[model samples]
Target: MRQRVQIEGRQLEVSNLDKVLFPEVGFTKAQVIDYYVRIAPVLLPHVAQRPVTFTRWPSGVDGQAFFEKNSARHAPEWVRSVTVPSPGSSRGRETLDMVLLSAVPDLAWSANLAALEVHVPQWQVDGAGVAQLPDLLVLDLDPGPGTGVVECAEVAHRLRDQLVADGLDPVVKTSGSKGLQVYAPIECADREHPSRYAKALAQELTRQTPEEVVWRMEKALRPGKVLVDWSQNNTAKTTVAPYSLRARPLATVSTPLRWAEVDALRGGADPESVRFRTDDVLTRVAEHGDLFDVADRTRAVLPAV
Candidate 1:
C-alpha cells in the first residue's frame, strides 16, 4: 500500500503502509511514518544541523538491517544534505554525503524506507559545512549479565554527580534497547576533548567502584556491572538520537528523561516503566516537551582532565 502526502510543502509518496515492522506489537510501516511525522517538531532540532546515518530495517526488525550513511544517491533533490570528511572511509571516498532530515517531509521519506533508527554525531556542521567541535559529551551505561536498566540508572546518578562537580549539567536517557546513556552539554575548543573527557570520567567512576563499573568493553569482565562506554564520544562515532525509535521487538524509543524520573528508577521503579513506545513518547512530548532540550541549549566547558 502506498499514499501521497503533503508535508512541509513537500510531496512524499510513502509505501508499505500496512507492512508489519514490529511483529511483536503489530506496529506497521504507517505507524512508523506517523510517529516520525508527529515527533518532528522536537526531533528535528538536534538532528537538523548534523549529518544522519540511518539504520534501515526494510524487512522489519526480525529481518536483516543495515546502516546508510551516504544517502545522496537516491534522496529527493528537495531533501537537504551535507558533505563531511570521513577519515575512516573504507570505500576510499574522502568524504560522505549524509542526509540532513531538517523537515517533516524528510522524516516521512526515511520512515517510508523502514529506517527505524536515527544516529548522529555529537557535533554539528559549521556554516561552511565543516565538522565542528563536539557540543556534548556522552557515556553509554551498558549493563552486562545480571544487570539491566535499574543498574544503569544507579550508575547514571553517580555520573550526574561527578559531571555536576565538573561544572557540566548532565541529562539521562534510555538507550531504547538494553541500557542508558548520560549526556552533558559541553563547550570545547577541539574535536578530541569530548572523547578524552568522557574517557577520563569513566575511568574515575571505574576507579571509585571497580566492583560495579567497568570502563573496558571486554565481554568477560562485564558480568554484574555496568560498562561505561565512553567511546561513542569520538568525532566519527554516532549516538542514537533521543526520541528516535529503536528497532527492538516492541518499538521502544530512546526517550529522554527528567532527573526525577532517573531518581525514581533507582529508587525501585519497575524497569519497564522506562521503556517507552511510540504512543507513550508522543504523550510525553505533549506534556513535558523535549526533556533533552538542555543538551541543545546549554554548554559548559570540559574541565581540564
Candidate 2:
C-alpha cells in the first residue's frame, strides 16, 4: 500500500511501512527511509553530482536483489541521468546512463524501492557534463581466510604510515562488511590522473610489506594477509560511501573513523565499536558529525607518482 508522506516539504509516496527489510533486527522499510532522510545532509555531499549504482532489495534483502543504474521513467523532474563513456571497457566502448542522485528526495525514493545500498564512483559529473577526474584515492583492504578486520586494522596502521610518508592524509573507515577502506583526498584538475598514482602507491605498499599486505586477488596469496585492492581506484569503481547501510545480517553501516579510534582497536576495543547500524549512525551524526569531514574535497595535491 502506498501512502503520501511529507519529507522536507516534498510530497512522496512511501510504501511498505510495516515490511521488515532487516529481519534480524526487526528493521522495517519505513525505518530505512527515515535513516536516509536523516543522513541525507551528510550523505548527499559525498554523492551529489555523481552517478550512482543502486542495490535494490524490493522484497526485503532475502527475497530478491538487483542492481540498477538507470533513472526510472517516473522519476521526478528534479532527478536526472547522465550517460558517460564506460571506463576501461573493452567491448566496443560501452556507455552507461546512470542515475545522478542530487537530492535528498532521491534517497527517499530509492529507499521506497528497497534500495539499501548506494555506490558512487570517485569522480563526479560537472555542470559541463564531463566526468571530472577523481580527487580521492581509495585503498580497499580485504582480509584473507582465517583473518578478519583485526588483520585489516593491523594492515591499516601500516598503510596509514605509508600514506602519510607519501604526503597524503589518510582517512580510515569500516567497509561495513569485513574490511577497511582508506581514502586519500587530493586535488584532481591539472594534476596526474588518480589511477596512475593510486596504482603506484598500492604497488609500492605491497612491495614494502609483502607479508602484511598483498595486491593480487589470488586466494592463495590472501591467506593470513590483507589484500590491498588497488583496482578499486579505476574510474568505474566505488567504495561503500560512509554511513550508507549494508544489507548484511546485522544491517551494518559503512562508518568513518578517527585515527584514534583506529588505534583503539589495538587497545582491545571491539571492531564492532565502529560497526554502526541505521539508528546508531543517526545518533552518531547528531553527536560527532560526519567522520569524513577531514577527507572530503581536500585540496592537497599528490607529490608525484
**Top of the candidates by TM-score:** 1
Give one digit per residue, the lDDT tens place, for model 2 in 1-305: 88998776677888879999989888899889888888998898888777888888887767778876654454666667788876554255487667776778888987888889998887778996678878787888888887788788887888789778877888888999998998888775442467677677667778988887788889989888889888777777776777788888788899888888878886778877877787777887888888787545455777665
All candidates' lDDT scores?
Answer: 0.91, 0.80
Which pairs of residues collide in candidate 2? Answer: none
Worst 10 residues of 2 by lDDT: 86-95
Query: How well does candidate 1 match the true structure, expressed as C-alpha RMSD?
Result: 1.2
Which candidate wins on lDDT?
Answer: 1
Q: What is the lDDT of residue 232 in candidate 2?
A: 79
What are the models' TM-scores? 0.97, 0.91
| True-vs-predicted CA distance for residue 243, candidate 2, Å | 1.0
User: On residues 139-233, what C-alpha lDDT tens digit does candidate 1 reach at each position?
Assistant: 99999999999999999999999889888888888999999999988999688888788888889899999999999999999999999999998
TM-score of 2: 0.91
How many times do residue backbones clash in model 2? Answer: 0
